[model samples]
Target: MKIAIFGPSRRVGVVVDNDVVDINGAYAKYVADTTDTARSTAAAALEVPADLNSFIEQGAGALAGAKAALAHLSANSITTGLDGERLVFALDSVRLHAPIDGKSRVFAALANFADHMQAAADNTASGSDKATLSRLVSGGPKYFIKDPRVVSADGDDLQFPRRTDLLDYEAEVAVVLGKRGKDIAADDFGSYIYGYTLVNDWSIRDNVSFGPDFQYSKNFDGSATVGPWIVVDEGLDPQDIDVEARVNGEVRQSGNTKSMIHSFAALGEYLSRDSTLFPGDLISGGTPKGTAVDSSIRDSEGGFEDDSAFLNPGDVVEISSRAIGSVTNTVTGTRTGKK
Candidate 1:
């Protein structure tokens, strides 16, 4: 099901497929109303459950109950419609919001590709041991956090900031955690997952290496563009999917999840062991080889030039993975108005 959380900040209403029904608020009320008297953790918390988290937290039984109620409702054709065909939105109608808002921690892996390592090695063959090394060659998934404030929806406009002119797009497959787990094993890892989503790890590569840390280049106002939908299905493997990025109709980057140095299950089990992963936390599986930003084949600029189609105002960036849906976002005017 394609679940959507919409409406103004305070007046926001959770709807399923543009329905007027308040699945979001109803799910919350279910927990608040039934937590004390609810007999089964999975007992029906409300007429319909808004998200997987609510159902899981309420317990397996509550989730089953909610599903049953939804099924019954479907059988009877009793439901509310939120003007599915003609709904008006305050933001750009095409603009997308983070599928799940306020994702507390965004753990991203840097250069988790052997190709990236080779490219980085060639770029610094002088052996000048400067800081800021690519983690793909040195260690496990290099984790980073994306500020929640910067998260945007799949089709929303990515605002370029005034700080830098160098902007690059990373095509990646991101995993959406459905449940909390600690020290989870790779073999038993599927249970903790909710589903998959597409994430474009957009960044400013030039200033990224200049700063004392990557946070500056990586965490701009609108860097993390994620999601069109959250898929909930079984028997799906993350490591065997095709990941690609397209700019304005041309394919800029293309690779497979199989190239990832670390698999999704491995990273999940590894990250969860000491720290708990809650529902809605995003773990980006990392970009693949062929990133124009990191390539040895430099454009005429001597430095990585924007000609590799560094995003300009009105450019469309699309990230797609077979396992998850494709997310197409447009680059609007830079936050600095320099572009």
Candidate 2:
């Protein structure tokens, strides 16, 4: 089942078709109106948290509670007086926030896709060695930490950094962890994962050559675009899902998760080696071959003269996947001065 935080109150919601059911509100009312024994049982069965992060931390219990609550609302519709019509809200009536927020560490893998690595390598200056890309292919999955502050929800504007002119968008599948564990095995990744979400790993191409750290380019405010909603991992295979990105309305990036050199499970194992992988922590499984800055589309002078290839102020970027829904954001604001 898909879950989201929507409306003015940012209440927890369960997505049913085109409507969102207020799970938290409904469960609270259910507890308040029921008998003492019933209330206790309901409370135990549905330990629904106020936010998405806490709800995910509850793991299987949360899933079971949500199902039970939905079942309860369906079985005794007249008794509760909170039927589908009253509890469910149309998708357009509410606004979405970053599904996982508040202390969720965002880890992103780099050069995990062969095509992306090749494209990035080909885009570099002539005679430049692609040792890093080669290392990524041969060695274990390499990851970088992204500031959770950069996370923006669907329909929100992606704020352009004042320091750079070469902004780019990367389409990736973000894995959300359900449980905390250290030295987690790759095979046991399914048990640890709570769900999956779409992520636009925005980057500033100009910043890469000027600095050794990627934080300056990748971690700017509103760079990481995530959400629409989270699809729970109920026998879902994230490794073979279709991922794509579009600017305005034109398709730019198109690839599959199956092309990933390091699978999500492998990346999970690598990430959980020394540190604890907690619930709500996000791990983005890198993008495909088609970023705006790809050398394949560059001219002989090594410049992309085409304005449409790169993002400009007021441009809309939509990242979509079959397993997870689409995350659409517009470039509403940009700063021109040097930092």
Off by over 4 Å in 2: 31-46, 75-86, 129-132, 209-212, 295-308, 334-339
Q: Tens digit of lDDT per residue, candidate 1, span 1-339? A: 333444443222223443433443333333434467543223323434444445334444443444443444445454432223222233333334566656356788766777655664554433332124443356665567788666777657787666766678888877777777888899987777666677788887663453358677888876888776665553567777788999898887888878888888878877887888887777888886556556644433335433444667788888987666688888876635344
Model 1 residue runs over 4 Å out of place are: 1-4, 7-70, 81-96, 119-135, 210-212, 296-302, 305-307, 334-339
lDDT of 2 by residue, 1-339 (tens): 888988876777888788787776566555655645545434633587657787887777777777876777667762232333356678888898888776889999887889987886776554323554466667778778788865888999877777777788999998899888899999998788888888899988763642367667778888888898889845778788889999889898999989999999999999999988888999999999888876334444445545356778888899998778999998866646321
Residue 166 displacement (Å), model 2: 0.7
Q: What lDDT, from 0 to 1, does candidate 1 have?
A: 0.62
Judge candidate 1 at residue 119 and give its lDDT: 64
Q: Candidate 1, after superposition: displacement of residue 205 in Å?
A: 0.9
TM-score of 1: 0.76
